[model samples]
Target: MNGDLNERSTGRQRVLVIDDEPAIRETLDTFLSWEGYEVATAESGEAAVKQAKEEQFDLAITDLRMPGMAGDETVAALKRLHPNLPVIVVTGYASDEAAMRCSKEGAIRIVRKPVQLEDLLSLVKAALG
Candidate 1:
């Protein structure tokens, strides 16, 4: 799914994408990889944390809702493992409370579902930068 973007110049930044839905995971993996990011995906928050321990990632994009270890918990766990790791939380059920909670848990951004690819990319770039 790698796109036309050059990885040598920019350096392929590894990105962790966590989502329970196969479609969502595929979408992020394809788009991010196309953008020249080395991407890894997990189907649950628990798996995401486990993956994080195994590999180093520049950034993480995760679904807010999941079966075990919710998005906020996942973000917290990631931070615990890597204090400065940046996280972007995406959810179909965006809410003020959820956003605030995620923010408090160390998420860099909380984006609602149906997020525009460009917008997500921009946020990712900013986070990586």
Candidate 2:
């Protein structure tokens, strides 16, 4: 929700969750929110881009594949909007090529799907603080 996005100045670092699946979006949003970070969700890379332009996020966790504007493209686009915005690519298929592509596109890390909450939290903390 926009409320979380708007509360950036309150000291709760913002995080963007991008994935096409409603369940994935909700899971990450709830988990991150519970972890005390302001969380925002996007159903597609396009929507994520729109939010990136309008708001600020300390990091983004995005699915590698989606209906439109795949994760790699999304990473590049987001970097253009916020050159230093850290991104973590989440993919079901973490092939070498895909991992390299994501790295090349400026992603800070690539996390395979069915994400482990604790590990993700570690990455999030390392990235944000």
Candidate 3:
């Protein structure tokens, strides 16, 4: 798959990608864009919260650790703003505890970093549904 998303389904979905790493954010933004998703990127949880408050998104993909608000907080904030919105938490530090915590915080899924693009795309599709 080369970690690239090239297929486009009908009715493009809007996705917000929140991560501190520029490379991760940009890469995801580009890949998802190419996949025909309306993508938005935020470098910090605070910024993500602000953006979510200002706009609507079908799904949100966020890093578990970040400078401003952290993924858990961001997910909570998003839930407050949009209760039905689905969130996916991505983390390099994949642990059972962290995954459980994310689930407790309302994330639809928790994906470990260096993620396969196909897995992510699949999760996004399921979340949107």
**Who wins the lDDT comparison?**
2
Query: Per-residue lDDT for 1-129 in model 2, tens only?
Result: 564446556688999999999999999999999999989999999999999888888999999999989999999999999899999999998899988998999999999877899999999999987
Badly placed stretches (over 4 Å) of model 1 are: 1-11
Q: Where's the lowest-lDDT run of ten residues in candidate 1?
A: 1-10
Residue 39 displacement in candidate 2 (angstroms): 0.5
Each prediction's whole-model lDDT (CA): 0.90, 0.92, 0.87
> Which 10-residue window of candidate 3 scores lowest in summed lDDT?
1-10
Q: Estimate TM-scores for all models.
A: 0.90, 0.93, 0.88
lDDT digits (tens) for residues 54-114 of candidate 3: 7777899999989978788889888899888899999999688878877888999999878
lDDT score for residue 66 of model 2: 93
- The TM-score that candidate 3 achieves is 0.88
Alpha carbon deviation, residue 53, candidate 2 (Å): 0.7
* Prediction 2 TM-score vs. true: 0.93
Can you list the residue pairs that collide in candidate 2? Answer: none
Superior candidate under TM-score, 1 versus 3: 1
